[model samples]
Target chain A: MTVPSRILVVDDDADIRTLLGEYLRRHGFQAEGACDGASMRERLHRAEFDLVVLDLTLPLEDGLDVCRDLRTRSDVPVIMLTARGAPIDRSVGLEIGADDYVAKPFEPRELLARIRAVLRRTTGKASAVRPEATRHIRFAAWTFDPTARHIVNAAGVIVALSGSEFRLLRAFLEHPRQVLSRDRLLALTSGSDVDAFDRSIDLQVSRLRQKLRDDAKAPLLIKTIRSEGYMLACHVTEPA
Target chain B: MTVRVFVILVLGILFAIAGTLHATAIFHGPPFRPTLQLSVLGICTLSLAFITARMVTRPLRGLAGAATRLGRDIDAAPLPVTGPTEVKDASMAFNAMQRRIRANVSERTGMLAAITHDLQTPVTRLRLRVEKVEDDDLRARLIGDLASMSDMIRDGLEWARSIDVAEPFGRLDLDALLDSVCSDAQDAGHDVVLREESAAIVLGSVSALRRCFTNVIDNAVAYGGRADVSCVVDGARAIVRVRDSGPGLSDHQLGSVFDPFYRVEASRSRATGGTGLGLTITRNIVVRHGGTVSLRNRAEGGLEVTLDLPLAGAE
Candidate 1:
């Protein structure tokens, strides 16, 4: 009795667009495709989509540029499509606000799973509002607010997080001072980066730590527990 | 006389002797007859001097031809060292220049390829997250777009990496190579049949040739429904032809097929998921092996891709 999540596909390939559109529809989602960045912007302006699947290479403007521009406007979750064996450029893509990336020649099922996971996390509070009237959570001299989708440092400067990173940090904030393993973090974040064998969580954590100005050797907020995983050492306080 | 002066003196003596013999019958061997003989011999000696001068300049002409060929074909055989010492030294220098150019090109290609390969991982991660969208439509579209873009990147990167001379050259059985390519196509659910495979051996980089055949056969199957591979000896050259049953290319598109990023169909839609660099790489490989690759629109409503390699042991 609810509307299906909307997805925007940005690629220049017609067959891929048609096949993916039909395939996603069969699985119960509303999917539309744009051939390039200009068309993607037009579609974004026309409708409110749940997520964007962006390809890095395009005709007029590239997917990286699109991701950068979208980051300035919306907090919509972005998954990048990258070439097989292209590792160096991947870091630049991640730095530009993309939530995750997948290699080419991927299985359709894997793609479907990723889509479902991202939607579940980004739309976690759909329909049902958190009846708790408070909008912010305070943890160890830091303030995290899902409504604002940002974290305020001790100096009160808002540090921006990408859609999935925000979700990940929120998950950490939700259970402060507890060790959260990779699987738990993956489950909480629910994006394409949470593959069975992927080490993206560690990388994301490192990135998050860098932004938070937390020392890796002696992390104050999030500490690594050797082989066990990660623990948020900060105490969380939700505003009444 | 010493050797050099002896040769010149001998030439003068022979001319003088011939003059004396001609004068003996003309008059009784005195001043009038001797003077006439010397003048006649002088003309003959002058002609011989002119001929020797031209012979000495022949090496310079050969050097010029070699220089011209070197400019046209960077990989042409080294210039001959049979000329004078200075000319030989120049030839050696030219060969060294070619080696440096080849080395530079190879190094650049290697760096580009390495950089591209290193870029794949994070892009893949970003792609996976996009796939996790709850909206089924958005998720699928995003994946499709990403896949195509990835293909483009791969092709672009591969093309950039193709300038290297890493492909090892060796003797390959032309028939066996064609058979393997056909089998690969069959494995990929393509209808590729060898019309007449020659058992003739080719001295080439086996891996490069295999890749070339793979690209051509793949195109044949992807665009054309079937492939017909065959090999024949034309004169002293071994020619291999791959015919496809797909809609043949236009006359104009034939020449452009081997150019990088040149798709016959301008749009390059998903139906034909080509990055337009396959044929370019194929040509580069073939040429690296001292072979030539060409494409022609077959009159029988299909396209024919042909490769001409110099026959092994053929003069």
Candidate 2:
């Protein structure tokens, strides 16, 4: 029989740790809890955990340090939990190689869904319904794995991407070389439920542009279509 | 300096000699025609001598030493009461004012602590009770609504009792603070990035400035998906820009964004709850630091929140 996926939940809050452990166990996964970085290190020594659910506000060592440290040693997918209400922290966490993130006071079901999604993406068992699964897009000497939610540069260095950036890039990759209007991009990425006046997508693009090192003066990968929105002026090859 | 003093003394002596001459002429030599003028001149000479003596002996003797003592210890020896009645009274008043300020600050801090502590139990109890509600949607909605109240209570108490809300002047690294803020947000799963990452230092209350930035950034991320932070240092003032790609506020709604409990979007229901105090608290903190916060919808689409603060150590 295949071993149940061992998930490590690291959080300072005892209640949250217990709650997540109970919830994850109910979802057909083996779960263990660690209150801080010290305990987390000991737990890691004991056995290999498939995935780690880490909180940013740990006691001794901060969550970001743990993330930076963990990424260096292993490819174990980590989903960070942050209480800070800042969007930059989220992007930074991803940039540091956190596989996924969920803000605090998050619904248990959403957390579960994210866990499952991360696991499926890592294990190459993602649903066929993900349209980008069949497409492989290359831009600016970077390879974007939409199914895996991973971006690797030419030297095979994993580039960190926020959730919004991932989604936006995926949209761009799917319709490569085609102009995607802001309204259309919003509809495709954030769904119609998004606020009408939200220019968040534009900011996300700006952030993504920074990561890609795309110059505003002369862009190569993602170019402004003007009057339209942005277009991914790149080559895409579908998975065989 | 010595020449000026000598010249002042010489002028005094000259005036005194002139007064003696005029007085002698008035009393014995010849009947003085301008008796009133001569008497006025004599009085003026006497007054000048008295003023010069006071300026040289009183303030000049003790002013530097008094300042040095005050700098060394806030509770140092009181200013000497030997100068003049007016100066002595002023010194006494300064000591009394210092004592009063200390007492008032301590009293307020204690009151804030008491209030904050008093509030936590109720909020905790409410949170515990909220967990027991079985209806998923109603429970979530109730909790969401309650969160705002709790946040408001927390912020209100913190604001009311903050010791450094009116902080003493000090220099701060504005650039480092912004960078740290951005880093903190980046750690929180936000898509916020510092567009212009340059180090600039300014003089202000560190905590108050932090609170100000936190409020503006929180509003941007909670309402908008991402925030673009930029700071432009212009001489003695640093203009901080926090631009968000959220739903841009209407021109009419822009004015009221900083009003407490005034939310521009009606759809800020349980899912995304804000106390509507973010902007208000932000503006308050900034203004307290002798800074200003302005919100305007960018012509290119998005809302830009600008914070103008006096640069630290700038003249």
Candidate 3:
């Protein structure tokens, strides 16, 4: 009764456009292809898409320009296809409101996984996963300041979190006491593209656990729920 | 008028007036007053010349000093454009020339960055395609080759970044920085020891300078078995030496070792993997901080990498 989530792929390469479109369709998702900014605009005007897989390099109009324009006009979630690996370019994409990015010549499956993750985060459903309008999250002796995107330990020293690591930890903090299945975490961390089995989630969880130092003293922080999934076994509280 | 000509003309006029007054005094008054008048004229001319010479040379000396500095340091502070209009114009032109040179250099660096960026798409594509190969051994080999290729390209790009150094400078502790780097190397199974006892404050882009020291210690431990790092302060500069016990480079290799990707592996072991740009980028970062990086072979069969950075107070 309900149409599947629609994704728009905007790329200049025709082979990539067709191949990627077919790949997404075979995976049971609807996809539309656009060559440049004008066609992308027409597609958006015709119907709303769940997410946009935008390439930073285009024929006529620059991808970043289109992304910046898209941010001002619509609330559509965008995942940038960047060829440059420079951190400055990545920061610029994030600054212009791109939800995520995948370097070009990327595996089509990787792109699909990212699209799904971005959609899950952008669609209204994600608000329930990430508490809305909260500034601070506290668990154990660590304080999570989402605005600064930094974690401070008991000594009040900041701990560095790689991008995926932060996303995984934040997901756990948000879904405290609830066992999060690998598939759910895969969607949460967007680390499921090449990971066929449970490689990504298991690796990310163990990494997060290590950073959290979840041991006998902090035993209940993150617990392996046997064959079920992973659970942040502690209470997640917000500063009043 | 030129300062010299003006001084001469003023002196001439004053002497003419003084001669006329003395003549009038001698002709109209006592003969005994002539000596006093001559002495007065002598003192006036001598004092006037001394003051005028100093006034003319002071600002000119400043301009000359600034010109030589501008020749050596492209980013030297502009000559104060606040003197006479002619001097102001000259200083302003010099400042403009510095700005133009800086802009030109940055533009070239940007072009290099853009070209290096072109390598990424194909590299990423190859990596993905390699992952799909059915042969396990072949796939693993191709992936490893691709990764090294990627690292090499990244080193080229990092070299460009070091040249630009867009990050703002910050004051950092030399001791803590070395401690962290040594700890990281040790964690990675490299035998690196840091003398954390010595403390020096330096102004630099923390990440850039950290990358420099990391590269040095990495090269040391990779070629040599262990790395011993020590920091010392000497006058206006802080010196850090990373010494390793590995086989040192020969006389010929030492000369070109810091050349991008220049490797001494021809005579030494081939186990180490590097894009060759490590030393190149390290040197660029150190030079940007008004520092120097030098490599020398230790008599005990190893290499010593020494870096000298200007202290914050010195800067």
Report, to 2 decimal places, the DockQ of model 2. 0.03
Runs in model 1 deviating more than 4 A are A1-240, B1-111, B128-131, B156-161
Arranged by TM-score, best first: 3, 1, 2
Over 4 Å off in model 3, which ranges? A1-10, A15-54, A58-79, A83-86, A95-125, A128-240, B1-73, B80-100, B126-149, B170-203, B225-241, B249-275, B298-301, B308-315
In model 1, what is the error at residue A107, expressed in angstroms?
7.5
Interface RMSDs of the predictions, in order, are: 21.0, 10.8, 7.1
TM-score of the second chain for every model? 0.74, 0.62, 0.77
Which structure is stronger by lDDT: 1 or 2?
A: 1
Provide the fnat value for model 3, as a fraction from 0 to 1: 0.11
lDDT of each: 0.71, 0.69, 0.74
**Model 2 per-residue lDDT tens digits across residues B200-315:** 65666555566678778877887777889998887778899999987788878987887867876753775566667667768767765667889888888788999998765566
What tens digits encode model 1's per-residue C-alpha lDDT throughout A209-239? 8656689889998999989889999777766
Q: How accurate is candidate 1 locally (lDDT)?
A: 0.71
Native contacts matched by each model: 0.05, 0.00, 0.11
What does candidate 3 score on TM? 0.62
TM for every model, in the order presented, reads 0.49, 0.47, 0.62
> By descending lDDT, how would the candidates be arranged?
3, 1, 2
Across A1-240, the per-residue lDDT of candidate 3 in tens digits comes to 057788898988775666667667777889999999999999999998888888888989988899989877887788888874355566576666677788754556677777776666656653242342245678888887553334666764444444456677877876789999988887776543444333367776765665566763355588887798888877778877
Q: Candidate 2: global Cα-lDDT?
A: 0.69
